[model samples]
Target: MLSMHYIQKGLLFKKPPPPNNQKDFIDNLLENLKQSISLALFHFYPLSGRLVTRKTQDPPTYSVFVDCSNDNPGARFIYATLDATIYDILSPVDHPPVVESLFDLDRAINHDGHTMPLLSIQVTELVDGVFLGCSMNHCIGDGTSFWNFFNVWSEIFQAREKGRDAVVSHQPFHNRWFLEGCGPLINLPFKHHDEFTSRFEAPKLRERFFHFSAESIAKLKAKANEEANTNEISSFQSISAFLWRSVTRARGLAHDQKVSCKLAINNRPRIKPPLPKEYFGNSVDVVSTETTVGELLENDLGWAAWKVHTLVVNHDDTEVREMYEKWLESPIVYQLGRHFDPFSMVMSSSPRFNMYGNEFGMGKAVAVLSGYANKFNGNVTAYEGYEGGGSMVLAVSLLPDVMGALELDEDFMNVISVANFANMP
Candidate 1:
């Protein structure tokens, strides 16, 4: 329940092919959306519930859980209209501030789930298209579970429009698999929730979406493996390594300054008697690696990629158990303000999720974007390119000057564009 703020992400659909009877069109769409979400909740009802935090006397700790009883306030639904067009959102190289308005519960920390709805849906109407924004509590589940809900919600929406039953191949598995103490009454190390669970503003920064074509990614992978003298590096590792160095160098950090890379590793398949793929809960484990800025910059792409590859590949069952056990000993909830070093970077989400497939009978989504909850400097969120086939779009958040430098950095820009690396300057 520590690291998850409401995951604010959604799809953009071009205004329903000529969008006739604008008023009726939007009214019907909103009606269907609310109904579809209600049906989806029947299966994923835990989302309709609220979080309950109480103080424990014997252990002098805190106990937190989801209250799924009649107290469940159900998911929140909102309807809004924008004076702008979809082009205003997608045309710019950098993310505009207006994008945040698409989703409800702005900057609401998950701890507010005690009274706030666990999930919020806002359908923002635009002249050129429509945006479906979903904000789900991170404390209840990780991205896997969240996306599953997204897909299912769309599935139900499609079925209702067709007047047919939704045929989902695999429904969400609500049973949580745990090797440690997770409970209706598990004790936390804190005496009050307010200590670490309050509101604060994130640093002002420039966030942009940088696209990498399939061919460019392959080059990065091949180059990393070749330079490292081994073929063990994966695409994610290579790209992360390349970007880490690129961003660090752009910032012009001191050579000896320490910087870190953190990524959320799904622990479902990593555990003994591995948990089911459809399990709907928090099975994510964050793993990190650190090195001096000089080492990262001076090292070959292959060397940096291999360093990350080793960190992810070698984390076996033993590591998972040990990490969990260690957390139980000294549990500390995070504060709202600056949570990491000025130079630390964390990459989340992936190019693997079926983000573009969310077609609610309106056609395929044209783009994907996130909310403003966790937008701190050095935070990077990734999504699959709308025109699939191994392409990637990384939404990078960095200080204003640093972002400008990265855009101008010739080496970085080469890998960013759609063209292959060989067509260099």
Candidate 2:
């Protein structure tokens, strides 16, 4: 029964919508959700599902599925014995949820008092209690894509319930078509590089939080850029370089370790006849910045940023493209590979992901996952302006103790303190 519960976190529009027939309202919401998923190559995985539990005095966030086979299908929904009350959560909110503007919703989600596990709903309404929640395969895509799928489904359902034609059509990307267009993955320069491995399970994993102000990062970048005489490097790149160098440094301090940084590269282009912006699905690849810690931190920020940028931008390198094409041509890429230990860490900067328009009635999400965690360990996701202004958040897997040790490093501290914002205490 636990396996049937697919978990996803989203906000409920506390502020009610216009009164309408209950059946029409739900159908409309479902229609919009379906249309969103149809926009991409997302139907392959059954990741979308819905439920409606009887309202309780306490707010709901987790759904428990009951029986699997019977006339009633699953047992009737019951409230979680222990949970937070709606009044307890809403007493601090500055304002009620909003509709129309996505930005307004974004602000609500990011507010200080708002807590994690912000909202949860039962999963038995759409399916029998026996079959609850939707199971989405991670390889199908990322969180942004998932959210888009849900939103469109809601829109389409709403229209249909209103006795209107369903205008949204699903036009997801075809994996085979994408592969044929990109050609085969052949002998690439980095073909020998190993795939990423996981480090620990949930219980064994650790979280380290880092806060930095924007002014400090700007100053550091100004100095580095002037000294290095590089024009294109930006502040975000400079900070990332520092973190990359820091991770490598940590690995070295552990004794001349061979560390590699996986940098995510968006593949909208660099291929002949660039892919259209609207073409969604997973069109991303990770290029490794493999280097011994001894070589990575030997120089200043400029050198580090340049190396990282070079690795990222050169996606079309004959060898690199060859390796990818060859991998896809193999049937294995289509099948899930064996789970292995993740040796390296994934690094991503989301300066704008949270800022995108997500308003849909309820106010914005207080926090969004940085997209770093997986079944593996050593995932790192950083956001410079998560809620705008200058506040920053770093989601990492390092233990708090090691993070404290990093605070003592002069170079690491300076990079975090100056390159972007002041380091959080």
Candidate 3:
């Protein structure tokens, strides 16, 4: 009953040369990293555990749980070196290399069976910096949990370097029973097993990085609110609406074609008695808005933004709980792999993840990219840019043709900050 998807995140850190008094800086850093990871695992033991299924009923019904016993195999840690520099990746290139090439994917964690480690970290030493890639089983947690582990791990590393004991602000809660008790435990057999078998096929996709400056976001918000005739539209809604329209237009779908925009909404805040901020589990649900291509493109930007806003606003506590109950009735979730025709697009991650703040004593990350994002065409991941101000970096993946069209889109290019890409060395 393990989830078919593995959540993977990557962080790029600038490597500083060791002092004249110290030798082999990279080796010393790696040793300290290993120790820090060991200490961090003490607080996140489930990561070192295995996902095993236990019989829940007489007829072979089963439930999956993390086995963190002493004998359980520990999390996998891999180390490697790359000939290229970090700048080669951070620079704005017309056609960025596939993200997989930037990290050590050979040691990536996969959802194979009960014996597979729940977490795996691969550290690659690049010519100018380091790249850390973490893969966690999605069945155990979501992006929140993933970044929580990373931040804590970084805190431990920084504290260790300064000879101080790290103080954790929040501890993760691992009780899966709380969720099970709220609704029926329905197990839907995997119908698309073939999708899992071929998940790693080299995708015919091109990834691009788009920067939206604070001023541009402000303009988008203002335009959306003014067009919708309501000031209630959020920046996320506004930006998502703009992206939806831009991508739909880039794809050049039929006027009457049905198109959908899906967002991964975190339900923690919307739940009754809201789950603890440190609740380390999957608390996200997908909320989608569907409309005809003609309506979506012809309508005012506010109309699309309002549609996104309302779709999110309507999922109140009651609605979320109801959705949970329904999920329990048929607990099988399917993965929407690559979309070749581009009828829909999914926007995930958030600027709020604060990935740029993950400093491992080397300094803040120059860039952060999700190793597992954009597996499907038309996938968009938004993150706070390294520039600090309220700028945003969108990691977008689309078909080559659609991306070409988007690159030439005047309206879309007008709002994006060319300065960021222009200044790339």
Q: What is the C-alpha lDDT profile of model 1 across 347-370, one tens digit per residue? A: 888788878778886788878888
lDDT of 2 by residue, 1-425 (tens): 10111113233222233474545644444444434334322332322221211223344222211111222222112121213223322232111121111111122111111121111222222110111122232333443444445444445545554667546454344342244465322222222112222122333434444555676667657766765687776666666676777755554354356666675565656656665433434456657776666666677778877776677666774545686666655522211123222436566435534432343323442333321123234556655443456446565665434555566778766644321222111
Arrange candidates, best lDDT first.
1, 3, 2
**Preferred candidate (lDDT higher): 2 or 3:** 3
10 residues in a row with least lDDT, candidate 3:
193-202
Per-model TM values vs. the true structure: 0.95, 0.57, 0.91
Give the CA lDDT, 0 to 100, for residue 51 in model 2.
22
Point to the candidate with the largest TM-score. 1
Those runs of model 3 whose alpha carbons end farther than 4 Å from true positions after fitting are 1-3, 18-23, 55-57, 92-95, 102-110, 177-202, 338-341, 372-374, 418-425
Please report, in order, the local distance difference test score of every candidate based on alpha carbons: 0.83, 0.42, 0.75
Q: Tens digit of lDDT per residue, candidate 3, span 1-425? A: 14235777788877776452223777787788899999989998888888665554446464555778999878888887778776676664543554565544333334453666778788888877788888787777787888889888988898888899998776777655345355234344443434233343436888778889888898999999999999999988999999999999999989999999998888888887788878888888878889999999999899999999999999888888788677667765444443323578788888778687777767777677766533578778877767857778887888889999998999999988542532222
Please give the lDDT score for candidate 2: 0.42
Q: Rank the candidates by TM-score, best first.
A: 1, 3, 2
Better of 1 and 2 by lDDT: 1
